[model samples]
Target: MQPDVPTASCCGEADAYFADEIHVRDGKTYAIITDDRPDEPRGRPHVDIGTEIEVPDHKLKWDKGNPTGHGIIFLSRNRYVFCYVQPGGA
Candidate 1:
């Protein structure tokens, strides 16, 4: 499924973290990657859109403790994975 958001990136915070698109959206999935920079901005963080996240079913780490069950995993280091389950990561 295509992303509802029009644009797909907002990581232009002047020499900010290095964000790269490992895989472009193939009509379903794309990856917005970033490095583990020590100077990552905590406030007013950069945003990325028009990106696709591929969360393999096996990649998920279920707590198996919570009633609703949660997945605590990330596909990148740029902190781009700060939201809920990525596009095609189910």
Candidate 2:
């Protein structure tokens, strides 16, 4: 399951470079995982918005919005997971 369309503060607009992954935790709160490829070490994970991820055997794609892109998680046959950024940050 996915949360409501997060406010602009959470999810940014959509774009080609705005690819991301939707992570689901026991059907509760949702978080967006992205990959980061900084020239310098950020001393953190490389997962940042727009980073391509391998989502199991499921197929993913963009859903809606502009400026930033959102990922739609396809779980199984009819199950689906919607991933979005919480805005303010990319």
Candidate 3:
């Protein structure tokens, strides 16, 4: 997590949100799009690789090997949800 990442919320939440738009660059999960809002500048919109993410119901190992980007929403460390966003749209 860089110092200039934007913060986001799902619909309406109080906790801080951390997002990383990763792509397979030389077989590495590189942070191409980040949102650290209120602390860092928002990055430009870009298309991510991956299929639609289903809302997670339990804690699972986040596989970064996938070339597609996945969006996840979690309630603390227990309840978790996953989804996918099209680059720049909320």
lDDT of 2 at 55: 40
lDDT of 3 by residue, 3-80 (tens): 112243332233213344434444433233243344223222222333222332222224221232333222232323
- How many residue pairs of model 3 clash at the backbone? 11
Q: What tens-digit string does per-residue lDDT give for candidate 2 at 27-59? A: 444434443345134332233464333443122
**TM-score for each candidate, following the candidate numbering:** 0.25, 0.25, 0.24
lDDT for 17 (candidate 2): 21
Residue-by-residue lDDT tens digits, candidate 1, 52-89: 45633333222222222222223235544422222223
Each prediction's Cα lDDT score? Answer: 0.34, 0.33, 0.30
Candidate 3, lDDT over the whole model: 0.30
Error of 2 at 86 (Å): 8.2
Candidate 1 regions with alpha-carbon error over 4 angstroms: 1-39, 43-47, 64-73, 78-90
